[model samples]
Target: MSTRPRRPRPPHPLRDRRSPWWRSAALAGALSVAVTAVSAPPAQAQLDDATRRITEAVSADRLRVHLQAFDEIATDHDGNRAAGTSGYRASVDHMVGALREAGYEPRLQTFRVPYFEVVAPATVATVADDGARTRLPSREVAAVEHSVSGEVTGRLQAVDTDGSPGDSTSGCETGDFEGFAPGSVALVQQGECSSGRKAANAEAAGASAVLVFGSGEWRHDRPARGSLEEPGAVTVPVIGLSYQAGVELLDAEEVSVTAETVSELRETYNVIADTGTGDPANTIVVGAHLDSVPEGAGINDNGSGSAAVLVIAEALADTEVENTVRFAWWGAEEIGLLGSDHYVSDLAGNDPAGLEDTAMYLNFDMMGSPNYGRFVYDGDGSGFGDHDSYDAPVGSGAIEEAFHEYFDSVGLASGETGFDGESDYVAFIEAGIPSGGLYTGDDHTMTGRDARRFDGRAGEPYDPCFHRACDDITNIEFQGLEEMSDAAAAVVLRYATSGDGVDLAPPVTGPGGDGPLMALLGVLAVGTVGLATLLMVRRRRRGPAG
Candidate 1:
């Protein structure tokens, strides 16, 4: 709903192909007016029936029950449900029980994820030429994830920083450190690359340590905590500073930094269950991150999403469908998208055929922000450009149109959010799977346009309790939750029942059927005809030569 203008991106690599699902003609006709009455098409009628039934069954009251249970679990165990914690394990157990109650044989997929925590407060101080030392506020300095525990003192050198809004490439490239002196503390801005790359570059240039500061639209009042990407990526200590704190050190001649931390690998599990009613070859994965940040109960942050998926799964347990629905509650999404990443990677490596059969993935995260705005993923790359690195797979646009159609049918206005690679859907999109999802809002401030559409406060974060200890059940907006969850359920059931607008070529099992093998046979048939025609032309020319 922000309507923030996005920069133009490179063209998507995936070729656009029409699918039986939302074809251009069908989509144009559907969106031309309100679809209050079901369309005459059988497929559209089936979709409408499924959407209404599922939406009616999975109400906000049911969602609240699950959220309450998650909150109680968090309360019993250390006030948080972060992965690698007892609270998260209990959360998983609770979900497993619910799945079984809903007639599902849920399985736990185990994986190890990197974990980092601050053992003590970090200190960063700047020294002026007159030898006066001034310590930056403790709240404004935080240790970057995976930073080595150590202390260092040296000259503070700003690396290619111009202090301009949304424009900085500090310490991203080796050339940025070309004229840097040895043993200096590299001062870099956060943007354009990973924090790990900046720290590694600084260490390679012989800097004793690094200080990464918040920039651009990021809040400058508090420390900008970020990860160094991986453990042992650099030997030197890396610290994060607020923008105000960093500006104070820009003119300083020297600085000192100290940090203490713990870093290790922790075990976690992803909950997966398959509804055995539909075809196994065309699986639709509906997922949400089950783990929360280390700071809070995370009721609204993810409990809203997780609960919606659970309720929808229960509501659709008895419904017959043509495509399989695989429900996933991803783990370790806070640190990174480790759970979903591992699932996709393992499938691609161990079951390439299965991965190919996957029709699409739908992700739901943070659905009930207090200042919520209905946001659909920019699958068409119109509102936000295609992702900077990976291309959105073909057929994603059709999925986007489906959500819009449902919203329009209900007379609810919606807006677009870019595929920013910040959620679990990142793994699916990266794998070139058709992906789309719904989100209310998170952390980012709502624009005037968003306020007009959703009637929430303007110029305020969508979720003020984001990643904080205050993100309890009370932080959720049930009205928005109900609307968003209904939209999610409607779209999900539509995709599960029909493959229209999706490229779902049947698996290669026989010589007949529209599959890779059949396409290959068609090509061979064309080639043989062309060869015969060429030979006849040669024979005719040979008579003249004789």
Candidate 2:
């Protein structure tokens, strides 16, 4: 049987609020020694020296350089850094140059990527007798366009109007158009059937136009094109709508709908910068998306994460951390994790130079919003209750623990968050490279529960104009940015200086993992020590002997 009984966390010494930062650290340290019987007294001393080193390396000059570069990518000579866009190419060049200037050799990882743009508005809905109506956006909605352009009108027909593809609409059989009439509007519900099949069925049945109900599901994101149908000889129009909207249209007595879509290919690029041997094997990767919605400058969406890594990399420049650090600026992340997916797929097997040396991947998405929730994803927790778990690699667990230690040292409250596919971390997670990072909230409103937990304003989005045009440099709060940057610096410094490297290892997991015994002990002991130090500092602040 396992002799390791679960350890309960010790009460926090700093929660008292009366204690100062140094005093709290001391108390936390004392408690840790009592519980673990592990004499880490020397470790603290070493850590302090390392912390000072990191602090000096992450100078304001380096941070300012990172921010300025980001401004160029997001503002200044502003342009869409869409994947395969000219702006993206320039952004890549700039990142490569910065990495080289920082004493790191950077390279580009090229892959074939398809680009898309909204050439025309998606249109398709029912203008019918019954109150039930259906509509879709120009792009997010389902739409189809012909090589030729023209509108067609006719008396509405209820073909396949029952909203079931099995009977009312044409089934798998393409020639099943035996009983339909000409010059009518074909209404088909979405299902297992393909768009091409549906269009063929409707065309064979002599329908002048067709309208499809949305795929049966709910979505908070914008709509987009579904499956494609090879351009056929028949010249008619087709469109799609939401499930609810489709039901309404089907129930209507008479309906008319229009649709349009652009099926063209475009190009994009993924920026890669490396600081070690070009060998992909046995490497550490940190990444963040470099693009934002067309509506705003994506300072928060990813600017924060990008800037954080840039600074961290710069500080690590002169350090001799065994593992090589490679930073990536992904393009077209907003259009789905396209950039990362492309890079991973290309490097998955063909890693000739041992690209698989990618032992660790740290992804930074959004980290600078003042009205945001900070989450340190528990990559290993089980998907329990309403939340799904992200199984972080052993190395990933260690990095997160390191961050906690850093923050705890500074007397800040940090929670272990879950790994959701809300950022670039998704790619590394899927690839099984232990992944972890930070996120402040986005443009979503914080509930009362969240506010109570995080102390941020509730009912307001983590980022007021998350993807809107207002996400500019002026909107960022300097204090918050500085705090977050400091945290980033601490985490990076700890990783670079620790002999164990960025990965902390297992049996010892993230905060409270396998139970909070050590954490509680450490917190208590550290807090006590911190409080004592604070008192000394205060006395000094008050002035010594006259």
Best by lDDT: 1
User: What's every prediction's RMSD, in angstroms?
Assistant: 13.4, 9.1
The CA lDDT of each predicted structure is: 0.78, 0.56
Clashes of 1: 5
Model 1 bad stretches (over 4 Å): 1-50, 124-136, 150-226, 235-237, 240-258, 385-391, 499-546
TM-score of every prediction relative to native: 0.70, 0.70
Writing each residue's lDDT as its tens digit, candidate 2 over 299-404 gives 6666667666777777677766655667787877876677787787777767634445676777777777777554565644532113554566566755665555
Write model 1 residue lDDT over 1-546, tens digit each, in one string.
122232222222211212223233233332343323322333334234556689888898999999999999999988999888899999999999999999999999999987777889999988777777789999899999999889888898999996665646888899999999999999998888888898999999999999998885678778767787767778899999888888877888899899898777789999999997888888999999999998899998799999999999999889888789999999998877889999999999999988998889998999999999888777767657634423567767667666765664455567767777788888888889988888888777877767777788989988989889999999999999999998888877877887443453323333433232332343345454433332332222221110
Superposing every Cα of model 1 onto the true structure, what RMSD results? 13.4
